[model samples]
Target: MASALIEEAHDLSGGAGDPLVHLPDTATALVFRTRADGRGDLVVVGPRTRAAYFAGKDLAVCVRVRLRPGTARPLLGVPISALVDRTTPLAELWGGAAVRLERRLTRLDGDRRLILEQLETALDARMRGPAVRDGLVGAAAMALSARGRERLSDLAPRMGVSERHLRDLLTEDAGLTPKSFARIARLRDALAHGGRSSGLAQLAAATGYYDQSHMTAEFRSLMGVPPGAFFAGRLPALQRC
Candidate 1:
């Protein structure tokens, strides 16, 4: 599981520009945002295939908990596929539980650590529930994120599953096909070294892309901008949930 984050944007008042964020392929985020007027909202951000624009209001505080791949479906009580490329209010999914959580958060004082602890506890409880674990999905995600590029066809036989079965498992658990997940894994690996890459060609080679053009096309399709624009600081820095 990704670590929880509590971000306070006290400086952002009166609608400051929010940065564009590229959500990762393997996780979903549960975000709780509170504005100056004491209005709080809860949202579940599903796996995003593209970059998203977000900004905070003045004196706003945001708390986020990121759920690991294949875990959100059980916690959210719905298939991850239902949430792909969308953000839905927590109330719509969790109903009264969402309301109770918001109320508890609103009543708390400005203790970021405490807030994070509470959120983590909530997630822990959900994870400990009767959710069936899919080891194959987790293994597939690990393989995709590993140092070397792995072909799904080859990986499937090694995992003792057929290629079609592997695809179905990934779709049900990760909300993505094997090919798409691998693409995202490669993209993330490249972006992690964005600050130090000598050039596009070098980045492409290091990230296992066919070439610079292949990397650029994937970057543009997923990030809404080319590598040049993204690395130039035109887009907002990615905030991991």
Candidate 2:
């Protein structure tokens, strides 16, 4: 599998049990289902996107495809932003998301094999035979854990690559540069760490921000709100995630 299992949070005994594909900080989780007859709908979640509350309620089936690095294309048939909290049908995201296989079947009504096959095909295409830069790419991602709060420039040389090269390699594997993903990862880490920050300054310093102003800009751009707003739980969807 191109992706791995990150976490399952809770048991899914009652719902359609689709294989969950874990992605790095930037990859979208494409969810779909397949049938034995070779037909299925595909829902591709885009980068930094969230799913509609109603989506999960109805569709027990989903296929998550983590995008290959350096590839900034939309996942197959689904729009990148379709999952960001809306009641729109999967057809709007992709024609596949609207196909209802279960409604037409008898015994196999709930079987999501068709969707899984389509995803397997898609993954096969993305992963192919072998990776050329697996060593350098994998090393760079693992290195981030050890270099927490350090700037990209400071960590690049130790990984035996230029800062630009490091970013390029990271983009190829994770769909985002090391520093950008790292920043998001750090922010997510801080958000989950849970506590009232003294202020933006303290939060910035803790998350490797050079200063409050810089942290504020970065936070606003990616988070779509001020850093304080996140701390205050103003973004309800994010809080739920």
Candidate 3:
């Protein structure tokens, strides 16, 4: 099923003057940048180990589709493990083919629907990756992405595979160890509850921390900010590049 490999496509654009703050994320995404001059770039935003801050964009619009785990390898034409915590331009990997695709996109003049369709067609043409979909990795990733305290040791047995084998598969296809994926999933849950919760302590407990303190430490560790400031939109000083 498409849902197993593709998360949701999203429009990440904001006010032209507002800086962008991207929180830590567990998935890989195809970021399509459309600048004001009717030409731009298409880049792969690999998984993030921590939050990232970007200066305001002069681009007219930006859209992204977050690909589910276990689905990007064929499209990338490289081992997923190589992309961890890195951003790469498609041209570096796809070469002239990538350049030709950009020319096609530039000719579209930034029409959102057309741009998305073009990208989708290109992905659909990939015979193995997203099209056929990797069953074992997909199932394992979904289980871990549920944000529960599911141990790989327990999951491995249920799936009829050794824990080491499962770990290796995910590390290669998902570009993250089982433990790291789980941590990001929990952070995602916390973010979903950020604005709706009555208080930070309650939110932390609800999202699976031992207590507020445990949650605070993780927030700092992965996102470089305490939950309070993160939820309040008051990020600490970060060197924006």
Candidate 4:
């Protein structure tokens, strides 16, 4: 396998640790990063390939527009469900409007600088279109909020929506239900912290799993590997100071 492409990101504005509002560089997934204080949002366009994390499916295709970083929240303006989560092409999502950006990456025709500038301008504007379902979109963003991720049952009640209803909303906006999203988010957090050396028991407890086996099962389903085998060689590089 090739090494994962890591970009030496240039800070557009604001200082470091502001907040990261980045799109997946591997797919059209929008990610809101509140991992560190003062880190601004880092909007990224994912590479065209299947996500190593999600087996047997194509990653979503879209641009992540980072506005600010600080705990996940309802983005207020962006649509949640308009984009598909499974292997959809970005060109199909934007209907050729993003030709410049795509061409630079695929055809290598235009100046990447200009393409980036155009994308930035569009991101700065508040999104508006017939395809956007703002009410549910806002709710979805709120669902992923820092506090919301911790309390699933409480979230639906607070929103005056049923648990099933909340799941539907999440599926529409995020292409996954609340439970699934929470699971992935928790797992990602655990991996980020534990790396390879962390055992199944530890990762399970941190993510609220009932036992190590449960976490192991989920790991296989989502990541296509058992917990132990997944981190065999990569753990050392992922450790934190």
In terms of TM-score, the best-performing candidate is: 3
Tens-place lDDT digits, model 3, residues 1-241? 1444457787765545566777777678888886556677888888787887666665665778788667777677876788888989888878987888878877887687777777777766663434423366768877987966679999999989999999988888778888888888898899998899999899988999889999999999998888898877886554443
Distance from true location, Cα of 1 in model 1, Å: 8.6
How do the residues 1-241 of candidate 2 rate in per-residue lDDT, one tens digit apiece? 4342221112222233232222224544444444335444444444452211111222343344444432322233333233322223345643542454223321343454544444445444644534436356545655563336456787788767799987776664444556656766665655544376776778777776678888777766666666687667564232111
lDDT of each: 0.72, 0.48, 0.78, 0.42
- Over 1-241, each residue of candidate 4 has an lDDT whose tens digit, in order, gives 1111111223232233232222222113322222233222223232221114311211122223332221011322223344333333434444444444444433322333443454444433424323344355345544553332746577778777777877775565444455555666656655665674356687777766678888777766665566687666321122110
Estimate the TM-score of every prediction. Answer: 0.83, 0.53, 0.90, 0.55
Once fitted onto the true fold, the runs of candidate 3 whose alpha carbons sit more than 4 angstroms away are: 1-5, 35-38, 128-133, 238-241
Q: How many clashes in each candidate?
A: 3, 18, 0, 20
145-207, model 1: which lDDT tens digit per residue? Answer: 577858898899998999998788778876887777777888888889888999999999988
- Give the distance in Å from residue 205's predicted Cα in candidate 3 to where it truly belongs: 1.3
lDDT of 3: 0.78
How many angstroms is residue 9 displaced in model 3 relative to the true structure, after the best TM-score fit? Answer: 1.1
User: Each candidate's root-mean-square deviation in Å?
Assistant: 4.5, 7.9, 2.4, 11.6
